[model samples]
Target: MKVSIDTDRCRGFGVCVSLCPEVFTLTDYGYSEVSVDEVPADLEGAVSEAIAACPEHAIETL
Candidate 1:
């Protein structure tokens, strides 16, 4: 699976970073960003959780 963050919809809550650090990180500007083009097998579940936990619904899978 692939993941991407819609920066326009982000509010820097850090839920994605806390739930899926392996694939997500907070930018210097405080928005969240995806660290990989494709989700690793081990991190897929965590990424999914992050997507759901995101209060702004900023994370999406492709």
Candidate 2:
């Protein structure tokens, strides 16, 4: 699965990063960004958790 983050909607809460640092990361400005273009199968569960945990609902599958 492919995942992307909506920077404009992101609040930099780091929930995604905290839940799945392998797929999400905090930018220099502190916003959460997608660290990978195509997510690996092993990390899909964490990615799903990150998506569900995101208060802003900024993460999406592509």
Q: In model 2, what is the error at residue 19, expressed in angstroms?
A: 0.7
Each model's backbone clash number: 0, 0
- Candidate 2, superposed: residue stretches over 4 Å from native: none
**What does candidate 1's lDDT look like per residue over 1-62, in tens digits?**
99899988999999999998889999999989988988989888898889889999989888
TM-score of 2: 0.94
Instruction: Tell me the whole-model lDDT of each prediction, alpha carbons only.
Output: 0.90, 0.90
Model 2 clashing residue pairs (backbone): none
RMSD after Cα superposition, model 2: 0.7
Candidate 1 accuracy as TM-score: 0.95
Candidate 1 wrongly placed segments (more than 4 Å):
none
* lDDT score at residue 27, model 2, on the 0-100 scale: 86
